[model samples]
Target: MNIHVEYNTEQNRCWVRMDDWRVAFNTAAEAEQFVERLNARLNAPHSWGMLSDWSPRPGAKARANLRCAKEA
Candidate 1:
């Protein structure tokens, strides 16, 4: 897998790209920390998986609504 990092001046954010996956962070340090965690998971002996609960948690809907509003 190849990773690339770039800063977007217009957005004033840092972005990290891994193939089709790209995520933006508020700062370069945050982006770097994300990369480091990802690297650690990839290099670990055991396989790591991502699990999400479909059941709602406290404030989950509110957070989702906020994100949707921000996107709009």
Candidate 2:
């Protein structure tokens, strides 16, 4: 569940790296929150890999809906 956060100013993008390449949020604040939550998961020991992407507001919303397919 752990997550890592990184910002790409050149690309004007923010990313959240976790067990899944899920763009948790489009806004930096939102992404940071998601990253914090993901970090909490790191408290538990386990093998983990990064899942990251650069997404804008629209894309983030789409991903959100896709994540919860029923919602879409």
Candidate 3:
């Protein structure tokens, strides 16, 4: 995702554009803080929950099917 911080002249405030979402902050400091937190989250490792350890039962057919689905 792309993030940009800029001042909104009409609103007299700092605004952060994260992809298609726009958020306004009363001060540039607040906007920068928000961006820092967002960057930290973006850089953090991801968790896949239950799927993290999941795998199809060992079989040629199952592996073939998985590959076909992924290609599609």
Candidate 4:
């Protein structure tokens, strides 16, 4: 997957745009640091996960299953 990260310091925010998904974060950080710095820098939500499955195939039913927790 491709992720485009853009930062707007004036607004104290960062945006993560992906081909099939999008999410907004306060600042870009390594996985470990995201938790440590999540509260201070976050004006809005620090991060959000976009649903990649927007629609189902003709023969498939739409469903979402969180397989497991990821590091970040």
Candidate 5:
């Protein structure tokens, strides 16, 4: 991912930019810290697992599967 920490002279603030999204910070140090943390998180190994075959219990209502439940 393309990311950069930059200072905006017009706004007198620093920001971390990732593509079209920009997160502003009051100081350059804050922006740099944010970038460092973001990089760390991105580089860390992910333990997320894929979903297995799953279903609601027998005799259960639609609400038992929250995804199948309609908004009230």
Candidate 6:
């Protein structure tokens, strides 16, 4: 998964995107720190594969498919 961080001039805030998750902060520095902490947690030796661990499981897949079907 890739992480994206950008500052929004119109809103005068910072935004962060990771996969389907998005977050906004009041300041660019706060956004940068959040991204840094996220990277550290993900890259730590004990949680090397933490990203993959968030993947939907079999039951979650079925629920997601059902939700999608309903939305369609």
Q: Which candidate is the best by lDDT?
A: 3
Name every residue pair that clashes in candidate 2. Answer: none
Which of 4 and 5 is ahead in TM-score? 5
1-72, model 4: which lDDT tens digit per residue? 454666778888776655676556755773224434433343344333433533345333332432222432
Off by more than 4 A, model 3:
50-72
lDDT, candidate 1, 1-72, per-residue tens:
787788999989999999887888899988888888778877777523423432246376556554431243
Backbone collision count in every prediction? 0, 0, 0, 0, 0, 0
Q: Write the per-residue lDDT of candidate 5 for residues 1-72, one digit (tens) a residue.
A: 889988999999998889888888898888888888888877887655512433335445644646521131
Summarize candidate 6's per-residue lDDT along 1-72 as a digit string, tens digits.
789897889989898999888888888888888888889877777654855655455576556555431133
Which ten-residue region of model 1 has the weakest summed lDDT? 47-56
What C-alpha lDDT do the candidate models reach, one value each? 0.74, 0.61, 0.79, 0.50, 0.74, 0.76
Tens-place lDDT digits, model 3, residues 1-72: 999999988878998999988888899998998899889977888778845765647577556546431133
On TM-score, who's better, 3 or 5? 5
Q: In candidate 6, how many Å is residue 16 off?
A: 0.6
In candidate 6, residue 58 scores what lDDT? 54
Using all chains and alpha carbons, the TM-scores for the candidates as numbered come to: 0.60, 0.42, 0.62, 0.39, 0.63, 0.62
lDDT of 6: 0.76
**Number of the predicted model whose TM-score against the real structure is largest:** 5
RMSD of each: 7.8, 10.9, 12.7, 11.9, 10.9, 8.0
- Extract clashing residue pairs from model 4: none
